[model samples]
Target: MSTSSTGVLVLLGAPLGNPEDASPRVASELVRADVIAAEDTRRLQRLLRELGVSTSAAITSYFEGNESGRTEPLIEQLYDGKRVAVITDGGMPSVSDPGYRLVRAAIDAGFTVTAAPGASAVTTALALSGLPCDRFCFEGFAPRKDGERRRLFASLAEERRTMVFFESPRRVADVLRAMAAAFGGERSAALCRELTKTHEEIRRGGLGELAAGAESDPPRGEITLVVEGWGGPDPEDATPEALAAAVARLEAAGTDRKAAMKEVASRFGVPRREVYDSLIDRD
Candidate 1:
């Protein structure tokens, strides 16, 4: 068949691990694309081989380093009425990958942009996590520095939706510990490692337990963490004394009485005004 004359760019989702996860539409598009842009040309070739889809389209490398330089050329091809297909090393393109820039360029150039959506680690982990999926947020990866990581967690401290994050196995424990400290040790969470692979395993427990275990074992391979959202305060367990003590510590650390009361109230799941009144009465 002749190459498509419609200047459309397709973002194809590659298999995360299981080759069969490739959708039939992805396979057909692979066979029909006029040009293929891949994050890793070799990996894309291997995936195509596994799917038994042969393509005559010229393959070009478009990864993090050269994505900017390659976007215009790809856009030019798209402008010339060619079916340009973009695929990442694994999963869908532009998702923590290098396809977003090209997609944005194509859209700006008045070219049609679409995707043959398929397997995604974000949704896959959320589904198997057994956590509340009704509403959730994806935090791709935590910041590397400790201060930045802490600040990031602080910003999300009040996020109600179940939180999903991707982390390197090397730093999984560290991130978990930070989460435990920021979100509380008792927060329900699940740590998923090597998902969909032969060594797939999902460990569910309190953030404290998970953080300790992750540190002890040091998981390997891709890691996806699913953390339960704040379910209000643990009034049944947190005593008034405990809340007051927490407020004192915050106040000692230079936090204003009002802010300290708010933090303590949130930390202990009590009424902010009551905590404030208690502080005032004690003073």
Candidate 2:
């Protein structure tokens, strides 16, 4: 169905913390859209008020809860040749937010999709993180469950690229602790909270120090964490003997021998067989 574009699907970026960061293009799209899908209808109304623009667009909620249910209907609107605009609570519509499904459906149905980029927490936190940003990865949100969270951190322990993660205020400390456990207590990191807001704060330290500090002074507001990658030698760089010695340390710290070896293997991006061979040589 490569017919002429029936309608346009515009994804607008909302301000992260500062309303002034909202772009003119975003405002224009909001005012011009025939239909607007918002993560929160009330928040969208507030944004419209701040922008001082009245929109006649049909507004509907399209957050994670209703995203699946809303996609088809929104796609139908696009097929009807109606201009549809999407906005999230903050930042872009589909980055750790809803709207991806609708975007995909719109394109599948031959509608033209476009974006009006604006303020983003991912880049904003990375810039303020004081860590290497030239190469980095954004991990949408830290997993809330203990085992899953640790597994996630363990999987990325040896990642050479700096890592960014969005976390809840309540779980920030726990996440830092988990990272320390998986990536080593001395791994450097930065915690950014309430970015661009009046109460904005940036705390930088080793994972352990950050975890400890969070105990006495609980963090508040939206949280973004930036973690330095393993900048030292890669695991493969270690001599087999060195691998055995490292495994020994983990065991001494109460990690099971098998578990320790597995962790070492993951951190080094090496096969477990190599780590096992080192342990065999030690024996």
As a whole number from 0 to 100, the lDDT of residue 275 in candidate 1 is: 85
For candidate 1, lDDT tens digit of each residue in 1-283? 2355758999998888888989999999999888999999999989989999899997999999999999999998987888999999778898887899998898888888989998898888889889999999999889999977877776666578999998999899999999998788988899988777889899999999999999888889998999998675556756656566566655544667788788877777668877876766666
Report the lDDT of model 2 for residue 92.
93
Across 1-283, the per-residue lDDT of candidate 2 in tens digits comes to 1123477899999998789999999999898899999999999999999999999899999999999999999888877878899999999988999988988888888888999999999999999989999999999897788977876776677678999999998898898999998888899999999988899999999999999998889999999999999775565477897678667756655679899999888766788999999998889
TM-score of candidate 2 to 2 decimals: 0.86
lDDT of 2 at 141: 94
- In order, candidate lDDTs are 0.85, 0.87
Worst 10 residues of 1 by lDDT: 245-254
TM-score of candidate 1 on Cα atoms, chains taken together: 0.85
- Clash pairs, candidate 1, are none
Residue 1 lDDT in model 2? Answer: 15
